[model samples]
Target chain A: MSTVREMLVELTGTPEFADGISDDADLSASGIDSGDLVRLVLLIEQRTGAEVTAEDMDQLTTIADYERFVATRGGAAAQPNGS
Target chain B: MWLTQLAERNRQCFPDRTALVDEHRSVTWAEFDDRTGRLARGLAGLGIRRGDRVAVLSLDRVEVMETYFALARLGALFVPLNHSLTPAEVTGIAQRTGAVAVIGEAALLDRHPDLPVRLRIAMESEEFAALGADGIALPELPDLPDDTPVAILHTSATTGQAKGVTVDHASFRAIALGWLAVARPADDMVLVNCCPLYHGSMVVSLTYMAAGATVVLMPGFKPQTALAAIEKHRATHIWLVPQMLRFLLQAKAMESTDLSTLREVLYGASPMPVDIYTEAAARLGCGFRQVYGMTEVGGPFVTLGPEEHPAPDAVPDLIPAGRVVPGMSARALDDKGEEAAPGTIGEIVVRGPGVMRGYWDDDEATAEITVDGWIRTGDLGYIDRGGLIHLVDRSKDLIIRAGQNVYPTEIERALRTHPAVHDAAVIGTPDPDYGEVPLAYVVADEGTGTAELLRHVAEQLAPYKRPRRIEFIDQVPRNPAGKIVKKLLRG
Candidate 1:
């Protein structure tokens, strides 16, 4: 399955741009603004087959945080695509 | 002191005037000054002090601008991180600057757990809100020299590392003053800034605020949301790159939204397509001006005024970068550094108070670009007999996508990281919507497929920086010194 970071790299369009990004780094610093973040959350929901809400975004500051949140919303379809 | 005084002077002169507005909130000049003062003290209590490098990561918000002014008040350097960069790129900058703290929204901070900093203050968390909620006494604001560094604006280099452009209060103030003198924005003009707040927006938004106008900030550009904001606020001015302008013109809201309130549209970063320009002009019936500047040279230092926009019948192949704005001078220098004759193409160079102090910790780069006092812009253009600056090409391998600068070397470096790739070269191909997009040429190992290479690049780079197409070749031409002949690839 593709990692959340992998998904971000695809969505954002910079090949080496996200290479150094870690789970706790500020995504905003990586140029992911609110609108991008909103879209990212929706994409995560689609791929994981889980509900990734705005409140979840407020709570999940890192991709690691999103990964764990998606884990909690467990199901067979909750796996990220290409995993 | 120059930047800090902007808020203080505005607050004293028009305390109740709305200074800034975003989707969530608005702040009057008085409230802005008081809050920033308190926030500065709060940051001080957290050990932020003079000369501190504070990095801010957030979307477009009043707090972001507040942090900018607050950091200036404390005589600390503000490093506004671009939200679109990768974590490594962000960390590289934060580390390069030795940022004392990274203040941003919690989600952003969460993404980069590895950013080395003394503190990670969540701008929206209860802890941070409490810091501002307590009516803490304002700290002593510093009276900085005009040349004191206020910000470190980052821009990409062909070397794959971003360079930080050190800007002083004087340079930033010069930009605001120069913009005011040139643009002559209405005192009550309400500007809808549709770009990210990290870079050029600072020039556009603050320039308006310096003129005692209110600025409405959009966190990110969405054609519909931008139109709604303009219609809702009765915004008189709007700032966008040509790509966003095209998207806005295509937005469904364009059919019904009342856009008569818009008086001026400022575009820059890349040249606007002739068709897009014509349609936008006809639809908005507003004056359009093109801005030409770079982060390395403070911010915007020149402008193509509304009257100078190309006629519908005229070919927009080489739109002028426009005349130098107030407080700046321009020259087109030949190979030997002599000024190029009018109508002769040369490197576009600028010298002005708005020029940056230098690249942070990059003396070699600083020296290479700054000859005597002029900032070598690296754009190939000529000064026409009528004194208009027309751009023909870029001497530097810089590709402007929409309005964003994308360096091919950075992408080429990413392609080389794949095991199957022997060598890669990237070049810009023109596009109607984005102006230009990267097209990559690859020399790969046996059995390496284009799909595999594409996926490899897609995983490493941001979406915009990724190669739109990959062309496989038997060999890459190079010189004796081993530099790839990019011209042959383009051919």
Candidate 2:
């Protein structure tokens, strides 16, 4: 199964994430807007069966933060490097 | 001499009062005054002179407003670039404005390296803060006429190219005071500004400041953050577009957030969805007002104050386009240019100091929109016996998706750029989340598919401006005049 990082990289379509996005990479600074965030939540929920609450979505500013959020809800354990 | 003078007056009158509070920090009226002054001196030090255009590109922040005031001090025009635009689009705007300098976030500068400007200042760098650091004396404010253009706001036109709205100090001053006269905001109101800095922030926040109220600035409107800011600041008033309010109401945080401090909720930009309006009014337990105006008219010139909004479920929809504010006159003109009888639908025409000087460098287009000192608002509405304007339809071929204006011609122009396309017509379809979203009907080459055409238009326009869906058609319907009959496309 594709890792969370892989899904994000694919969704963003930015090749900079080809090497795998860092756990701490700021998603908002990377141009992931609120609309994009809403889409990302749906993708994560579909892949991991993790329901990201609106409150959790507000706190997940960085990639690692979101990975941890999904893991807590029974998603795949984060592989920061997509190894 | 300029609108910034209000900031100066506020600094003296309420020196120790909180002027602006961002997520990072807060600045008092005195500091806000001093910082903007220093930044003006810094820009002047860069050899930027009066009448030079300075483009500012950034997400909503206090520095953006500071830059606005600083430019006003120097008599320079503020060109706010919508950050959603592509780099090429940004460059095009900068080139058109002939900007002497550009101040933006680091990522923006990196994205648009080709921006034609003599000076580029990165907001995150020490170079930016040093502009307002101590020891550099502030320069004297420029002596300019009230009609001196202070801001150039670009609004999308029917022609597909964005038309720049040149607003002068007189217009801002008039709109700010006139809004207060009409809206009658409570004394000592603390406002949380949740809308984008580029849009109604100036008219709303500045007007509150003019009334000696503290205006808290949100970097961007995330529903949770917006709620937190209001509760934390004990904010008494909040200004937002209906779309943002919808997000706030959907947020789970709304269930628990202490929004008791909120007294007045000002909503506009697009018509408020009745469901969202009713739900928000009940949930927040706050009085709601509807504002109706446009960027071309120097922000809001009409308001349906809280008293006018009926109790929830009192009517199918209680939304009113609002009545003209003091110093503004409105008349609904029929197709023959005569006044429409009361309650008869006609184009809403407005004449006021709030009207813009003219579209920047586009005389023909400016002439088209204005006639006899009255600006054609492009809105079809009727005035009731109560003098409240009720919007029945928008005659402008513009789609308002989530409060952002999307011109069909602009999207159609982008869709035609695809090599596999023949012709395209764009129309607005009703949406639940957004008031309306664009729907594109296309007659395309045999090989082209929906996904390919979608991606093609996405590349040329901002995300909000792109069509939500594309329908393949045999041919685009047009009249003998060769104009696409958009109404048929809607059918």
How close to the true structure is residue B331 of candidate 1, measured as C-alpha lDDT? 87
Please provide, for model 2 over B1-491, each residue's C-alpha lDDT reduced to its tens digit, 9 standing for 90 to 100. Answer: 45678888988898999888887678888988988888988888778789999999887777888899899888999999888777767777888888888998887788788888989999888999998577776566677788999999887777666778899998888888888887766657888898777664457777778887888887666776778888889999988888888777766567678898988998888888888888887777778877787887888888888887877767455477778888888889999988898999999998888889998898898899887878998999999887888898888888987778889989999999998888999999997667888898998888777767766765667777877778889999999999999878777
Q: What is the lDDT for B104 in model 1?
A: 90
The lDDT of model 2 is 0.79
- For candidate 2, the docking band is incorrect
Runs off by more than 4 Å, candidate 1? A1-83, B132-138, B311-316, B458-460
Q: If you score just chain A, what TM-score does every candidate get? A: 0.72, 0.66
Give a tens-digit lDDT track for model 1, residues A55-75: 344576677776777667735
Q: What is the DockQ of each candidate?
A: 0.08, 0.14
The digit string of per-residue lDDT tens for model 1 on B298-387 reads 778778888877665564666677888788888899999999999999999989888888988989999999987999988989998887
